[model samples]
Target: MTVTGEDSVIDVDPLEPPLCAPLRRDLGWAQVQRMSQSAGHRDDPVLRQIRATAAVRRGTRMTKVLSAAQVSGHLGGWLPYGFCYRACDIAHLHDPQELALLGTDGAVSAEVAYALRWRAVDPLDYEVPGGPAQPGLATLQAHNRVGAMILGTGFTPSTDDLVPEFVTAGFADLPMPANAQLIAYVPGGEEVILYTYQPEQHGWLRLAGPRWRGLLDTLPGVTPDREYVPCTTPGSAKLVGQIRDREYEAVADPPEEFRVRALTRAARYPVSTLSRRAEQALWRGVPCWVLQRDDAWARLRLVRPDNDALAATGARCYERGVYESWAPVGELADHHIADIPYVL
Candidate 1:
């Protein structure tokens, strides 16, 4: 992965937002300092043991991804027209040259299927400049993901959920391992974002706001006001007129589990800073309440309750924790909080 100096064509610093100072008092900072000190000290056997194991706990933060040049170079000529690679293709690319490219030609569907098969063999082994995992690149190359559906004018609308069905059926046709799954996003309306998952384990992952905003900036002509519309059904015949291919099979039903869960059960996890007012608004819609996962972090969904746009009509924050999990109380347990120990 090439690391062009700050003068590169893609000016990263300009794309980033300005940093702000903390608002807390000295005692608040002192508590954090003490925690850090205690965690760093290796005197107690129990603390040391937990810290050792915690080192392996994969950080859930966003991963750096490749730019357009890196995606094309790494694909090594496998790239297709109108199918330029974007950073969104690989959610975990740490280097510019090590992107997990997704082909968009009719072959794109098939290629992604093959990639998933490759990723399924004890997946999570890929991490550039390998550490413990030697086959990280290989594993990364094995899985291809279409982060968001962005087709130009297409022929007829599909009957099968184009994004989801295409992924699942495409993988099903390949000789990939049974464990392989396909995930695709269909951005329809602001209220409804469709997540199609196949092989079950393949679940929906929301793109961070800033990252999604970056994607909009990357595509030259495509602006936020008019992003591509998601194809609702497969083999809609409408797309045939837009493109040349129509051989891919469609699915019987779109995967709706993730969508349902997010609205009904999964905890609301935002990636940007939200004010206290916003946090309260978000809480009113759902039964449980929460702040950011980590106190040091600053995302509105994590800290403040969002307005009516995100939370349901009557939710509230039941518990609070610093730099902890967004766990609600009193209402039905948000299934999303079971794994998290710290509550915010």
Candidate 2:
């Protein structure tokens, strides 16, 4: 495994909506913090822990993720394109290079995946000139995921839920580690994935082995929006694709600024400032309720009898009259909170 480091860059910051990071019970916060600073404080980088897999506790505010330092070329790091290394946004991190390695997904998806990120082992990071491979890069590469993300239905016009249709359509079942599982995302009305989530996310749905070729050409889940290409990794092993779903994309190619990384989920967590406007459309048809509000960038919690988007996703936040997580107003939207709440 080769390790690489990136140069610090300055651009319009795309604030990854804050995620309530998950920690191992045995792994204390202090230890994780120390490890993150020394290594990649977490996966990807400080502003974008892309490789995170965070899960909210069954009934608690706490979320947990298993993250370690990594620095190898990303394989399928992005969900829709070939691999491209991420230049992290590290304004708060002490080391611009060493990020807090947290989980399988990073900060961007932290907002998209509804606080829970999918954790996968990416065994392709190579050490670059300034970026030396971190301690666990090799172990991560050797870890194989065992699930397949066959094309499925979301809100598309015609929902394709039949798995057997794939074989009949000449797409054979690809091999995956017994532990692997497929994830689905609908990025546009015409395609399932096109514009990636973030920089590292350009490598769409990472896969390994020779069978990857057949799968890329034939996956039924893929919309006509993808542009298939051969792998560009160290050994040139896997086949990847670049998404053509630019019609629905909110940002530009090789973006100069950070735009929406996660478009599916709304910013539900409370913050010091409220930015929910009718235009941001943070929620998919779900309207957010103001539990309480003060000045800008103040704390807002989900009070009782608010909304059902949480229940719809089978998730929640507030419990026993306490707010679990919160963020700043500007981070979630471009406007300010206009409501004056009467709390019970």
Candidate 3:
């Protein structure tokens, strides 16, 4: 096959190749040196000479290049391509069973986002948005019939904006039960937004920095060794994982020099606290960090760690699960550091 260049067609042999694989083989030495010269340099003696001879190529800009499948290939296995259902699919999210899928661990989390239908509301009663002609309940039900989708609240249109009056009522009765107090007294008369509201328990919920440690103070219910450990510290270190020698050789290549340093800082007093601390630390990055135990084996699973938090803080801690009992062995020396956990 002939690969077309600016002013030449270089025959590219598919089956055979050369050792010093030419990155710019199609271009002549003058062209290569000219094009590769300091892009905007006018003062350089060599660059000025090269630029004078070379024809400046104006390449066409690409518009629609990579398709969805091609883009997904580049993203690898992190996010499933087809799983991105749009805002209109919000109805499908209504199924109470679907809520279970939002969690990092097998645990379920209670979160909701209502799709907006309209904006006008009755002035007499703040709880009622739109008149009796356009019932709020019917609009919500109509959306519900379309099949639930994960509602994106971050979108421009929100349920509150659609029914400003109703939202005002919602805010007024913040502490009150929606069904009884807020939903009962709409001008047109209606039940409040009837969502299967579950108390947010299980999964990796964002806990306040110091407030999360308060759980440790209340762990008298559990056995002495099973107390909660608060893991909150910051620093960073080059993470080393298991790799075959050949793979390492390939990445390091031609007498590779390793210069990354591991960071150590105070988490809490006892070292066991480092496990949970690392898990919490990783909350800003990766998946959930949960310590799971099965029979004689135990592992820290990288399920749901806050990738955002990790990036925000320089603290070198695992946002996911860290195996407290795991140890370094063979050629993995001087990499691991012990962080003392904070004591109450």
lDDT of each: 0.22, 0.22, 0.20
- Best-fitting candidate, measured by TM-score? 2
Candidate 2 lDDT over 185-278, as tens digits, reads 2222111122112222233333323433332333334432344322243221111212243212122112122133233435211122211111
Instruction: For each candidate, give its TM-score against the true structure.
Output: 0.18, 0.19, 0.15
Off by over 4 Å in 1: 1-59, 68-123, 135-218, 221-223, 228-344
User: Model 2 lDDT vs. the true structure?
Assistant: 0.22
Better of 1 and 3 by TM-score: 1
Give the alpha carbon lDDT tens digit for every residue of 124-153 in model 1.
Answer: 211211112211211221112123222211
lDDT of 3 by residue, 1-344 (tens): 12233666445222111111122555444443333322232234433333222111111000111122222221121111111111122322343234223211222223221111111111111222122211222223222221222121111112221100111221110111101100001122221221111111101122223423332222222222322222121112111212222111000000111111112223111111111012211222332222333344323222211233223322232101111222112212232232322211
Q: How much is 203 displaced in model 2, in angstroms?
A: 16
